[model samples]
Target: MSSPDATPGASSAIGSALYQLATRAVRRLPRDLSLTSAATLATLDKTGPRRVTDLAAHEGVTQPAMTVLVRALEESGLVERRGDVSDKRVTLVCLTEDGASYVRARRQAGVEAFQRLIDQLTEDEVRALAAALPALRRLDTLDGQKREGTRP
Candidate 1:
């Protein structure tokens, strides 16, 4: 029988490992942008133009906080404000061409760093990770669902 500490079902151990890995990965990112800014940029890139309120909700931030972030991004030419066609009073946030390129480059750098680390893993370990990728993606979907007040 395995010791309690050795149990594979230990949630705390899994959470700790996930946190450490995430922290290290973020540290490996380029110094050009803060993680929160990078995250906002990436989200805009992936989801196209969005309302400030919607973006704030998606990012789990208050509207005022997101407004501050959006202002900085706009000042840096990384985002632009456009009038919403259906609602002229509401402004939508979208990435400029330069913003898209910047986000792509930053993302590529992070991918390269991760790829280098993955190269050190054995073929079997790499395959194991590949197998787990789907489940990891599902976790993101599940989290989004939870945030949207939906049952996963």
Candidate 2:
């Protein structure tokens, strides 16, 4: 096994690789979809309907910014605003079927791109990546916690 001290450059190397991959993947997406909009759709698809204020908080944007995003998405028929049943004054944003399908297609495209790259790896490397997926997911969660200034 590699000693922790001996791997001083490894973290930076991995970070650089991830950044490059993400940049390339984003470039591969449809020009019509801004990254922020795509992210909002993905979040809504994963988390279900939420109040506009809640989405603003989650996305770290002002309410006005989120409202603009929602409006654009609404115009595209990707999202719909529904009056909250419990509180008629509150409007919640939910993904339409089209939105869900769009998000899924985007996700699949990203996965396919990554899979194409991963296919070049050796069998052992692929197995290692498979084994590391859970840890990588945990790391993602930890990163999110750090961003939110919360303990992991």
lDDT of 1 by residue, 55-79 (tens): 8888888999899999999999999
lDDT for each candidate structure: 0.87, 0.88
Q: Could you give candidate 2's per-residue lDDT for residues 39-126 as a string of tens digits?
A: 8898899778999888888888999999999999999999999998999998999999999999999899889988998999999999
Residue pairs with backbone atoms closer than 3 Å in model 2 (clashes):
none
Model 1 reaches what TM-score against the true structure? 0.83
lDDT measured at residue 78 in model 1 versus the true structure, 0 to 100: 96
TM-scores for all candidates?
Answer: 0.83, 0.86
Once fitted onto the true fold, the runs of candidate 1 whose alpha carbons sit more than 4 angstroms away are 1-10, 147-149
